[model samples]
Target: MTNTDPDIRRKAEEIIFGMWDTLTEDERKEISEHLTIEEFQKNEYIYKELEIPKCIKWLISGKVKICKSGVTGRDQILRTIVPSEIFSFRAYFANDDYLTSALSFGHSVVASVPMTIIDKLLHTNIQVCRKLIKQLAIELGKADSRTVSLTQKHIRGRLAESLITLKNSYGLEEDGYTLSIYLSREELANMSNMTTSNAIRTLSSFATDKIIAIDGRKIKLINEEELKRISENG
Candidate 1:
């Protein structure tokens, strides 16, 4: 939904207070001055590859996908951003243009804090810098794990891992079964490092085996243990 500037700033304040407890009042106030909220439509580009990284982006609501295009013109999804998650600042730290692109996986609300302000804070607030370092490390570890899985796992295993990843990110709907996020097979294939045809066939196979129940784009995880075993074995 839409809200007034004051409302948005209040939300921004709440988010900062919860996440950045180490920041002093003065620092928080200054950072708030540079904060801006943006609304994005599904599939809208948040940042394109090679663009100068100017700000740190936080997803306040909905989902986002970080992706890079390959030599064959296929896009590979690198990561998914959930609510309250911070992303897109690593490129700024590396002092380079964005290496990948970010787009809205669905309609989303995002908050941006300019890197200039962040740099000033980083110089003054040791705690903030440490927090950022830890965050980067966690992301690096996940990336490493994903690399191994995609390179080593068979198509079924990769798709299983992708489903588990989605479940972890969004959880289940009120029915306590269906995946909360709805994605097309092409998007699922991109995230799982497979072709659309493979994704479709594997999904059908999973359904036939009673491992999952599919309702168009909605996939309900019916047998998570079997899925995990497949992922582990592959």
Candidate 2:
């Protein structure tokens, strides 16, 4: 993580303290002293399972996926981290090493906040502690929902839901039809909790039925209502 753009750091700083107007000048200075910015290349492994969690990461740009590997070497993508979201720090709070891995979806920027700073703030700064608790609860809720959706849904339903999730996360491209994120079929399958072959075949079926249009790694939703129905019925 070596991109040295000064403006990026400023943006990251703004994001961290943007909502904390109640912070005193001294507290803000302490925060500035602890925050560090890092960059990641496409497909870079940001953190791996069993690594000791040293800091919290706030994604400032691009995307990241938190996933775990199965005994058979298959990967299951648990969640995708969007800009302004935090990842890989719950283990730190829980006094355990990371249980999953984080990989860059592409070139990305992350602001590293040390555990010491978070601990200090949690004990001394009531506002920051409450904010952290609220944010973690929200993430836990989303994770539980996704767990149910991925496990109970059929392959087609899961795939449709994944497409819908991506749409909501990144929005549409300028074409107003294509998804903003372009992922390989294998990656899509992992995220959808299906085999790569099944994902490819289901996507082809969707294309045939006019549910979606596929162009290389890009996907365009042609019949979003029908896809939504499938997702709901699942």
Best candidate according to lDDT: 1
- The lDDT values for all models are 0.91, 0.88
lDDT of 1 by residue, 1-234 (tens): 333477766786688667889999999889887888888889999999999999998888889999999889999998899988889999999989999999998888888889999999999999999989999999999999999999999999999999999999989999888999999999999999999999999999999999999999999999999998888887
TM-score of each: 0.97, 0.96
- Distance from true position, residue 39, model 1, in Å? 0.2
Pick out the ten consecutive residues of candidate 1 with the lowest summed lDDT.
1-10
| Displacement of the residue 140 alpha carbon in candidate 1, Å | 0.5
Return the lDDT, model 1, position 55.
92
